[model samples]
Target: MGSVQHLPYSVSNHCPLLVNKESNRSSLRDQRFYFEAWWTLDDSFEGTLTDIWESSSAPLVEKLKIVQIGLKKWARDLKFNKGDKKRRLTKELEILLMDDMDEETLKIHLNIEIDKDEVYWEQRARTNWL
Candidate 1:
């Protein structure tokens, strides 16, 4: 059983219609891997990379495939909500500034800004590539 609905124009100009079916949705495994810029901000990313590289003794292409699989798992475990984190950090910074300066808040705010820069550059690079 399946259903279809017309999605909002704001959803995407290219994909304004939604096809609802158990099999209509593409499996995540079918998707290509693209390394995200903000992934470097995660503490576990380095460990995941090191583990993947060390554990894989296969040839270059096979090793790359392993890396891709490992990274996808890492991404799943990340559970990062960038938008919510940014909003929370921004609010915390505002509150801290209202009373007195806080070093920790400043540090967190700076880190988020760097993450935003990474995303911006990544998008720009993708657009240029296209």
Candidate 2:
């Protein structure tokens, strides 16, 4: 079953309408392969990529497909939370600065900021190039 609702439109002449479906249809999208910039920062990333490449025994085209599948799996297993870590580190660094600034804490905070920027620039480069 579906229901239609009329929404008041602001700045527009026509009224907005929304249709809500009650069916349990899947809403997931078919995500394409995209490399994460932060993956390069991980110590094991190089070895893992090398292993994936060497383990594949297919032609060039097939090998590319295998690598894509392997990368998707690897990304799923990574479980990295960059945004959460950045926010938490920022808060911790602020507290540390209020008391007594430490070299290690400052370094860790800077590293996180660098990682965030790397991801941003990587995406920006891809957008510009494409």
Candidate 3:
């Protein structure tokens, strides 16, 4: 007999999945800074965050705003230097290709960055990874 294939979205455990959706119906709200998961990857992410939080003598809300400002600047600077490592790897690959040297490591690094970029854009586009 041919093996059974599970259909897409089929659940084997016979349990229905319940998803809770957040509604944005609150028309009146206090302004707040939005933090993103990618911000944690920034250089000095933890240090800057801790420094701003610790040094702030303002109210909690003001401290939050200060931290947000610091993080925004840090993220901006990080953005400018983004892809430096990948660019370096690409340059090395070019040299290797020219000299016909081993490029396995460079190719691996490029592949990893490509994967990261793919995921980054996919999340940005709100596409399902599955």
* Candidate maximizing TM-score: 1
Off by over 4 Å in 2: 1-29, 80-130
**Per-residue lDDT for 27-58 in model 2, tens only?**
32245667777677765679888999999789
Off by over 4 Å in 3: 1-32, 92-119, 128-130
Taking every candidate in turn, the Cα RMSD to the unseen true structure, in Å, is: 11.8, 11.4, 15.0
Instruction: For residues 92-124, write the lDDT of model 3, one tens digit per residue.
Output: 999999999989988986776666567567667
TM-score of each: 0.52, 0.48, 0.50
**Model 3: number of clashes?**
0
Full ranking by TM-score = 1, 3, 2
Write down the lDDT of every candidate, Cα atoms only. 0.74, 0.73, 0.70
Sorted on lDDT, highest at the top, how do the candidates line up?
Answer: 1, 2, 3
Q: What is the lDDT of residue 116 in candidate 1?
A: 62
Q: For model 1, what is the C-alpha lDDT against the true structure?
A: 0.74
Clashing pairs in 2: none
